[model samples]
Target: MKKKLLLVLSILLNSYLLSAQIFTVNNIQYNVISTNEVEIITYLGSDTNIEIPNTAESNNITYQVVKIKNGAFYQKGLTSASIPSSIVTIESGAFSSNQLTSVFISNGVLTIGSDAFSNNSLTSISLPNSITFIGDSAFANNVITNIDIPDNVISLGKYAFVSNLLETVVLGANLENIGESAFNNNSISEIVIPNKVTTIKKNAFSSNSIENITIGSGVTNIEEGAFLYNPVVNVTSLSTTPANLPLSAFDNNFNISLTIPENTSEVYANAGWVDFGSVNGETLELETFIIDEIEYSIINLGLRHVEIENYYGSSIDLVLPSEVVHEGSTYKITEIGDLVFKNKNLSSVILPNNLTRIGYDSFSHNNLLTITIPDNVYTIDSYAFKDNQLISVNLSSKVNYIGNEAFSENVLTNVLIPNDVKIIGNAAFYDNSIRTLTIGSSVQKIGSYAFHSNKITNVTIPDNVITISNLAFYGNKIKNLIIGNGLKTIGVSAFNNNLLRTVIIPENVKSIEYFAFDNNPVSEVFCKSSKPFLYNDLFANKNNIDLTIPADSYYAYNDSYWIGFKSITDGTDLIDTTINQIPGLLLISNHGTISNNLQEYVSLKIYNTKGQQVLNNNLNGIYIVVANDSLGNMVVKKMYVQ
Candidate 1:
């Protein structure tokens, strides 16, 4: 009995020494113990056949087996590896550098670390459905011919399962993400990405010799150069209606044919793979239009194609066909499209009298110094002559309507807006160098920004005008504004930043748009009628000036915003009463004002030498004294003190 007990104690002591010794199994750290002749360490170095111990006691210690790590028998000398169901986590770097003919991971293993079983000589690997995460570099550079990732794995890390001799990679339905370069440089003839994968990183299967690719429907933004320079035979994105397939996403590939889905609307410019290629052996169509006996085509977005005939004159300076007459009338042939002659260096163009509407962007961006619009043309399209370096334009009075942005950014010094024009769109003359603008008496409406950002010093808005669009005269250097007697509404931001000294609001005008004259340097607004001129914070800064209102309208003006004003009945009396009445009026022009005391009524009329009333007003107060004989020119008048 004493000998047996001593022998048991000796065995225990030997197990302790063996367990304390650390050994590196294929570069993996492990502590083994040997007891009672039981092997504590197992070196499965590139072995093909690996069997988990069943009741194999080591060091007399009962070990709890948890997992059979990946590469546990990678490239091992053994021919087969049958993993037991007791494994849970296949730690990274485990089972590597082993020569294994076959690897069978049991279903009980839940996690597989990276690089496990990589560079293996195994003919096949059927991962069980128990794997949740295939770690980085797992099974990379392997000899696996085909792989179907189990539905249980959720993610695959970078280089995991890459560089394998895989002919087909069937990602499982449970896959959520494919790591970068996971399947790069692999012989994947075809791959059907799982719909569960939300992202496929860069170079993931980039250099793979894939003849077919099936992208899942879950992907939205295909990362830049994701599949660039690949030898993909047939790449089909699952998205039937690709929202934003970039221009260079799949460019530079060796694909035989591509079929754009039915729901796609726009195809990018360079998306056709090469610089110029026939779409199904047919050239892409573009918008084409004709003008002046010449066919113009706008190809590929902005390139203009023009084909000319030889029947026209080739004088080099002026080109006009010999037979300009087409119909019985003097009008010649006519056809014009948008931007027909835009950006051209043509020296001159002669339009026949039969010509009508000028097309949109017809003469835009041209360097022509002078242009003559024929009297037969009644319409001018938008941007017809915009941004042109023209010095003068002979606009025929026959032009009835002008479209939006017709003549913006031009160099015209003076402009005569025809009375036939009914509508003028926004920015029609914006940023132009026009000095004087004369609105014809027949004009009705003025569109937004008609004369904005121009160098106009004087403007005479016709009384028949109804609506003045926003910012009509904004950023102009105009010092004088003649508001017509029938003007009604003033649009927002109009007359902002002007250097006007005084402005007379006609009685017929109703609404004054917000910020119309907010920042104008005008000192006073002259009211010729009894009506009150509405004011808000827009006129808060100009509250100190004295507002001259008619005697009857003084109460209305005072109640609104005119805190300071001179109440007068007759227009002539104010000029004769004292010189103080003409405060800001003379600041612009020193023209002496005239008064008529004989006119007892509120109306005062000043006639010129032709006996015609050149100026008519009703306000009567201490007016600037001046003598007006037969002519309306100012004559010397006796000055009066207060």
Candidate 2:
């Protein structure tokens, strides 16, 4: 009898706490957990548009309204709602039966409960980066045009986006599961599952208009009807072994075309993949060849052309083959495809003598120390050698394009751009240690952020480039910069945050954007253009910049925004912004002398007043010496050399 009474008391206490947590404030009912924590349980007012406050005052206590409970806004007269960042969870059926056309999820939301936005009229929704779990039927029956799953999402619940009119679906990099009917009845055209996905549950992507799909290597299972009712035309698998694809997984779509890796054809063909239309691997007959004990997969573009896709086995110096023989047929290897040697610890690579092109990310994120591009190559695709320890690279004269971020984040000290290059793509050499760069004469443009945050001390842009895009040299240690005459525009923040002391703007430069030299220590400008276009804040923070204009146009510089500088002078005594702004005259002994402050050796020369060199020699106390280097940074001493 005593035990039964205690149980009944426990139940009654829970009931009392539940009642105490529920309260009404301004005709709106909320559920309170603590004195300072609450959730919107239901709306008692008749407001059509609601701006949910991040925090509220309740009975002299400040409460954070963190959640919208189940059925809180059901059948409400709400047309729009502004969720605050403090709200982390949207409970089941929270916004159902509302005439909502647009809903914004704030940045701190972590979970969307089951059916949270189901049956709503949302046309577009941007899932915040903090979203991790999307519950069942969370966004079903919407008109979402495109969806980009954030990288933090790990799982999609069953029927998550069912019946949506989604035209595009971009999967995140960390998604691991596709729950039952997750994307059913959509209009998605293509999908490339992230490399970490391990499963596709029942009918996950069914009833879609998907034309192509790429299954990542980590996928181990495709449950029955996972892709049912989709007219998938092509499938590509990055797996070396045949994955378990049940006959009903594809709904036995007989019109599918599948492409597996070179050696997995037989395993895929025997696993019911041959039933699909035109298995290319079964008929094309891939051939492998050995080069210095390393094996490579060569795809015959025809009898005369070939591509080396994947190479196995590593040597300190990898030497590719010029010709590959397979099945008694000879094909000349011509190109390297995407990610051909990515993530490898290769120290060096020797291209074939007849190689013509290297594709995207071909040698990215490797341990290569040096590379010599063949003379016949025409293109170096994006991310070709990014995130490496590469110290040296020799480009071929025939190359025309250096793609985006081609050699980013490397330790390269110098680069000699080939004379045939026409375009330098965005972020081509960002965050590198390239102290010396030689832009070729044939280049037409330097893309955005092309040399951002580099160690370059001096550079000379050739006359062929017409534009230097925004932030091209935003954060560098550059001391000297020479713009060519063919340039038409200098983009926004192009030369911000440098150690520049002088600038020479060519006569053909038509426009310069704001913050082009925001934080530079510019003292003089030799501008040749009489009335070149200049914008506000061109020299944002540094007020000591001096603009030296052409003799013919003093009014143009003194009247417009160019007058904001520290001073304006004539271009007749124009200054050159060389790194050797400070005189480096020093005293060195006749004996062997190392730098007293880790300085590099400067040139020792004696020159006559007519620009004629009288003597140039090593450090000796025999003659008065002058100094200059390639970067115009010299460590000179007034020592006589014998």
Candidate 3:
């Protein structure tokens, strides 16, 4: 009985050994995990292109190949590999030390062990979304240029993807940790860490060309030398609490600007975060955050409003987000900070709807061809859109201020200053190709060189303008000019170098400085001022100009400057009876009959209160009539239209 029991035990042990023994099928080695399941152990075939079979025939039974064992294809001269969908695991050194340039990982793969595909020449690799774990040195020593980690990946092992040629890296949203030297020695310029990653091991991103980095909110600890030998310029941290980082983490690169959450500068400073370059809250006077690559600052906490601070992206056409959410609070973007998008080479940009102000040099030095200022924008600061390629600009109706050189050096063909603007800054529209310009009715001052070097043909200084600074409209092709009634001072060379043939100075003019109207071929001058305060060489060809003054005002023009004109005329018969009129200008009856005593006028135009020309001259409202004569003489009068 004892011998028979011993024989049964020996036979059972032999049967178990046969079922689990290593076997070969089609020059491929395999080990049986069960009666119906097997794992690939080694490849004995001498082929450069490898296709591992999903099933193996052993002992007249078929078994499914589900995993690649350790060192299965190590040191094999493989050029390409096609992994089967049934493969769930690839153990350590499965395909290491090969010359693989192409690899197709199937969707069923869940894990890649240490050095699985290391020491290869792969230029690119597509990681399947099914992968959850990547062991140490899995894909190191490759030539890949870019990488998009699978969203399902949770663990990235040490030395993974090291010594590659990566330019851009997009971390997976669910990744929990970054191992030591994970992405060392790459060419990555920009990287956005997902919110789930909490740990960054030592030398994780060392020796990379990273310029901009955005750390997620979940990151708590960064090991020493994690970012060693990197020239990082801009860093955005979403973590409200400062992360623990050694001074050697960035390897003496303490000049990187840091942007953090609102009102957290004190904590960051205590944590040595201020030891780096300027902190946004402390230096920039505002707490900043980044959303979708655009940096924004919290301007008003109670109102939840933000201002765009900077843009760290490489897109030619950009559309700014209207609002952003940070730390469970929503903030409406209402302004653009100084130098936000300067020199970005942008072709087009769409401003946010709620944006109310544009800061200095906001969009300067770009390739923008057209821009439409939003209706809510109230201010455009100095050099806001200077040195661009703009062909057309639509000013906001609510704009109240335009700074110096705001639209300078552009190719603008037409510009309409909205009615609310009060002042035009010096050189505001200088060096532009403007052909038509409309000064708003509320403008009180025109700064020096405001409209210089434009192709403007006509100019009508509205009734509210009080001062025209030096060189205000110089170097323009202006043929007709009508001064407004409330003008007090005309600065030096204000209208010099224009193609003016006729000039009409209003009654309220107090002073006309030297060269105020120089370099103009003025054949007719109509001045309604009864007592001209002071004057200099105001006109280039004053000896050939015909001066027309009020009928009883000839006594005031007896001075040497006024007598320099070729002729002075004062005829009382040209005056209107019902109105305090200038001689030889116009006569308007209560029934809106506009007739001038002089028959030299060739063309007549009528404009309403909003500066729009009307066809019918017979209307019962206060209107402005502009008449031009054959001799290039012009008369502008306010009359009743019926």
Candidate 4:
């Protein structure tokens, strides 16, 4: 009897534990553990006020109320309600189309689904700091006047707040990025995007009545259409110092004055000109932007007074005021701006005593017969002395940089470059009549077309020159070339149309750039060392010419490649005698045709004055008919009738 009693007690305890919080109405037991919360499933009547209980239980079994599913309370009567802290999530359309005056999102909730509060009567909202995300169209079509986003929210989905009656938008400091159309078509008059929020998505504020925007400084790139159709005016002055104004940053807007700060120099494509007027007068004042630690003044426009500080004129033998100081320290203007004297007719100019820099086009098109550039001058800007009748130019020892077209079209027979110059700009000496070129050893880069189309007959490139740009010596009458050992890159068309019969590229040359020696009459090439000199069409097709590459570089040659003639040194054992044999007698007929005269049974060898056989073959003697002047009369000679 005792064992049966213990078993009954155990069974009773198990049944009691299983029926915890079970509901019973009129003694009818109903399981409440699995029943969903009483979601205002569909409001039968337009009740003014509504409430949802935490639990609906008839028997003793409790369930956890987690969410209000979508459309649960569509068109409900409640003007506003505070969601209980136990609610963790709200599904899409849960409270949509309701007369919800406002929503108090408690801290326990994690998500608000799409259209959850859409088409509601909420005037504004302050999201709980614990909410992480709001889905698309969650608060769209609502009467929310302003929104204070939660600090913990990471992103806002597209159309999340579209058509809301918003006056100001305060983004969360912890927000990383915003999605497209997050706040479209709102009455957002002012917004302060935090520096931590790096991006503003496209169409985020489009068609809004946004009249003012203050972009933060930390943003790098403004993406396409970020602020499209905004009513903001005078955007440049919005920030004390705006950063990274990209191209079209201010497009499709109107502004009065654009004041580029002293710290800002680069104005990217069309960013500051939103239908701006042509030639807006400016008074630029920059400070402490010193190169080589020399302070200079840009402009000192007096207040409310238009001062034409400097005049650019076309005068002969013009002398600038000694008070003008540009670029560096000593009050002598060192540099001039672009097109300062582009088409002037200055014959002989004596620079001001303290003047240092000659700006771009300072003395271009001047028929200057002679000029003595002072030693204090350093930089000669582009086209400074171009298209002049300069028979001689004495550059100062302190001059370092010679700009492009500096001495082009001059009549200088010879020029001595000092060791201080490190670079020569493009077309610096083009069209000059200099017969000899002596580049300084300190010069490293020769710019494009530097000495092109000149009467230079010989050149000894300095060992320090590493790069020779394209067309450097094109159309030159150079008969001798002494390329330096340190030369590495020879640019395209460097020696085009030259009369060079032989060229010796030094062993230190690594790469010969494209078309470096094209259209030149270079008959022979001798590379000093076995290190390969890459020659692709270096000697393209002078059929009657000879090329003698290094003995070890014979493996780099192609038989069918049209390097027409070869003269390899005897030191190269790689030469196969059969392939090295000359074809036949090179009959130099008056018509310039190469042929052979041969008797099939007889073998003959023909050699020129250099002890190299021109033709060696067994053939019948061939006759190439040639017409020449014999005793002042036209005569035909069968010269090679062997």
Candidate 5:
């Protein structure tokens, strides 16, 4: 009838171009998408353990590979990837620059596009609740450490999981927005942020190592440098209308301890959000009142103070009441709010001599062996008494700030940092079995990894320490370090891996960075700087140490970092012949033999004027020898050991 309808429309346009053709079977490359589906498109397989198949026969017609197209396995040297509930959409730069450490992602993954799995070495990731949209830079620069974002994740695009060694993120409660620089530069120490997120974009969580942020009352547009360079000490914000941020969001952390919603703290202290620090609101109309059955709360009904907040009596040896009259109103408890006795298997509680604040994470993960920190506490906020089973604490000689990880992972065999502690935050007493640490002459900054991994054997940095930050006393068994004439910066790896053999660098030490005495076996340094002390690879064993400069300073230690010191001497006639032979060099004997002609005496402690430690040749009454010299020079004589 018209040439049989033009030959049946030319056989239905050649069966729709042979079902959108582009084929290849085992080494993957698919694209058919019709006669029974198929999408993958690239990966001419050199197999670094890939397994992404789910059906692909090609010309014999099998298909059903679903979608994975754009730049399919871009730069694939993928170490391990299984991804196959017929992968629903994984497009842009598919497995970007891979050396992927491990990825399973199977439940019909719905969308994970731009730079998908970017530059990988992924430590751990399993996001497939049929993932809803996670595009830009998908798992960027990954050594992923942890991630959970999949509760049907709704959009997370820009730089999605940027630079990841992310220590735990759980976002995605139908996440909504949160894009630019997505979880930027991770090591995210605690972040909650999920209540249908609502825009947190720019530099999303910038340079994180975020120490506790919680923010989610449907967030509401946080954006600029999102949580810039975080070290955010305890935030909380369930948004009782405080969102509009931008004082550069949270860079320069402003000493945080926020927590809101309840009387809203004067609308979050008039919206600058209390300019960052102590907010603490959360009162559901206050009036709690419970005494020995614990609860408390009243918060300042005109100075009748009160605040234990919650503990329904099951005493693992508890005892609190500094004042709790209640209906007839006496109150005066003073505060111990956040997570009141957390995980309270409290093996000794007793703290309320009108406790003046001990809030966030009050007695964290407890089984407290002994605490006693009540001198009207003056704030001991972050993880106050952290992960306890603490073998004796008693700190708070009116504690003037001792927050981040306050007494972290403890076994504390003695840690007295209380001369009204001025700032000893980050990892404050971290991983401790601290064998006698006492650093408090009003400690002025000793934060990062402060007393990290301790079993301290002499580290006297207290002359009002002016910053000894990064890795402060790193992995210590510090055999005498003593750098504090108000030390001015000695940060990166400060006293790293120590068993330090004599290092007294203090004439207001201006910057000693890098691996500050890295893995120390440092044999004698004693630099009381007459200037030139801006070091870097500080001293693993700079050609076997022995530095000692401060005479005419030997033209500031003849350069090249004290000429890689294995002898730079000139210590002003060895410090005026060791301070004029320390007034009769302690020669005691008569069987209590103490003798010290002082040839750089390393450690001789006799002690007994009731400071109890006698045995330097079995010393008796009024002793106190205390020698210590490989030039950190301290010869405290006073002997009468007869």
Candidate 6:
């Protein structure tokens, strides 16, 4: 405990100031990446069990251990180790040649460096979905029986899993490059490569236990000797043309049947398909058709629904069929594939009711003016409608997520975020012209830059919102804001550059970050916190603003930050709170009486032929009611006779 607790002090000493220093806990040294932020750099303990904490404390400073640096845990002897979610990278040879039978890598890790876990004794390992790259020889010579790469991963580096005892390997959906000899000596029997992969480098799977393989439609190249040695019996390629490959790609693989998509057998026959034993074509429930000179591929989602695969159109108003017929199958379009309209000159498009999911960047950089998202859509992936000239969008009420930059840089003037959304991703509404936004009661968090640089004038944040992240409403001309009570935190610069005159903060707030309301001409702040909360330069006072707090909690905001206000008080009443709004006009009440608007009359002045005060609140019948509002707008009305 001495080693661990003392390091906490080291973190707090400089972490907050963006300062850093190395520290040791339990003889394991950590390099301070920031204050209370660290990366495991050396393992000095002689223990057999290793547990890396998500948080490390030294001197009251809580450090997030975010990385395991290169060669940090390269030494052997320990049999088990666990890395926490705070970690992001496992550097080259970080845990090479370990005797561990178990290692848990959390989803926060983005890269497993070259030879990071080679020659490990682990029988099973789970790489979380956050992984993007498995570097050269990363997990080679391991005894793991199976592996499932996450869909976000892009590259499997050269010899990544060479000589492993892997019998099952599921390639991720987004993987683009299988580097040279990535799985050169694995025992994988068969593999279905996802369609997104673009290249299988030379000798990528040479000398494997593979007997069959299915190459998806997206692959464009098969380098020499990609399948040099295993006794491959059947090969299925969905590409309409033969992948760019050398004659030696399958030179040694004899007695193999090469199967191509229907109508593609002749295309591959002339491009080294004969190197295999035979070539044949199979119709696998997928077809390409020309719609307005654009090539489209469709596949059945069910007996009735279909999904659009690709769009190779140049410039047109694409009208996807509500129902398309292919191979005697009547299919209702249900989804639009990722990047379906990316970088295209699609002027307009219509979606069918059966459509549900709009994939990432589906309509990004398009010239669409208005589009109707059908009711059934539940997910609007990141960048789905980004950078469009869309002035109108009819979003489905059922959409649960407005992804990062979903409608950013659009011409939308207003948006009513539906009730089902739980999270508003970062920069979700950046640079939009939305003057009015209605957040449904179900929204919990407004992410950073979610509404920055908007023209919103007034808003009432629903009571359900708990967090408003950094720069959420910065650069807005917000004049009237009614903050909710459920809020816990206001991130740095959350509402900077607004035109607020006064704000009554909720009582449940606990934290306020740096410059949360800076760059504004705020006149007053009514704080309700009984216990003082952490504060920063929240005020850029252009005029005197009364810092009002509860009488019993005067000391709560009696700090340096609060002292910077023009004046401080605990008074709630007698403060100007009305705005000069458009007059609703005088109307006779249903009760045959008129309610008076005396918001401006702090007190009454009377005159009876000689400037004499007369009959204030003591009048009986028909005395004239005269008063000015908080904005000094004078009014006169005849009172009712009781």
TM-score of each: 0.40, 0.45, 0.47, 0.43, 0.35, 0.46
TM-score of 3: 0.47
Query: What does the lDDT read for residue 316 in candidate 4?
Result: 70
- What tens digits encode model 6's per-residue C-alpha lDDT throughout 474-553? 99999999998766567899999988888878865645788888877788788875445546767777247777776533
How should the candidates be ordered by TM-score, best one leading?
3, 6, 2, 4, 1, 5
- Lowest lDDT 10-mer window, candidate 3? 573-582
Question: What is each predicted model's overall lDDT from 0 to 1?
Answer: 0.59, 0.74, 0.81, 0.60, 0.72, 0.72
In terms of lDDT, model 1 sits at: 0.59
Q: Alpha carbon lDDT of residue 431, candidate 4?
A: 93
Task: Give the better candidate number (1 or 2) by lDDT.
Answer: 2
Error of 1 at 148 (Å): 68
Off by over 4 Å in 1: 1-293, 296-331, 345-347, 538-540, 564-642
Better of 2 and 5 by TM-score: 2
**Stretches of candidate 6 exceeding 4 Å from the true structure:** 1-304, 559-561, 571-642
List ranges where model 5 is wrong by over 4 Å: 1-30, 33-93, 96-115, 118-137, 140-154, 157-319, 329-349, 352-357, 360-369, 372-380, 383-390, 393-405, 408-425, 430-453, 456-473, 477-642
Which is the leading candidate under TM-score? 3
Q: Write the per-residue lDDT of candidate 2 for residues 503-538, one digit (tens) a residue.
A: 888865656788898888888777876544545586
lDDT of 4 at 573: 45
lDDT of 4 by residue, 61-176 (tens): 44445566677666554466667665677778878765577677667777888888886657778788778888888987665778888888877877899765578898887776
Which has the better TM-score: candidate 3, or candidate 6? 3
Better of 5 and 6 by TM-score: 6
Residue-by-residue lDDT tens digits, candidate 1, 1-642: 999999999998887777675444333234443332222134534223466642233334544456444334443334456666666777776666544447777788888788766644555788888888998888865557788888988998988976455677788898988888787654566777776677777667654446566777675445554553344556555554333443334422212234344443244222333222223333434333434545433322321212121122233244443223222222233334556677675556675455555666876876666778887666676798888776777778877667678888878888887776645666887887888888877665677898898888998888667567689899988898888875656778888888777777776454576788767766666776554445644443464444555543433454456553333333333422233232112211123544443211223334444444444344233334443322133333333322
Per-residue C-alpha lDDT of model 3 across residues 1-642, encoded as one tens digit per residue = 999999999998877986678889877899988768899989987566788878888778888899999999997666689999889999999998776789999899999999999877677999999999999999987668888899999989999998666898988999999999999766789889899999999989976767788999999888998886565778898989868767667633234778889888788766656444467733445578988889988865656888887899999899988889999998998889789899999999999889888877999999999998999987787799999999999999989778789999999989999998866877999999899989999886788899999999998899877678889889999998888886656889999999998898876565678998999989988887554444588988987888888765443455324766776777444323234333454454455656554432336777888999986545778888887754455668787767
Q: What's the lDDT of the predicted structure labeled candidate 2?
A: 0.74
Where in model 2 is the C-alpha error above 4 Å?
1-303, 314-316, 570-642
- What is the Cα-based lDDT of residue 277 in candidate 2? 43
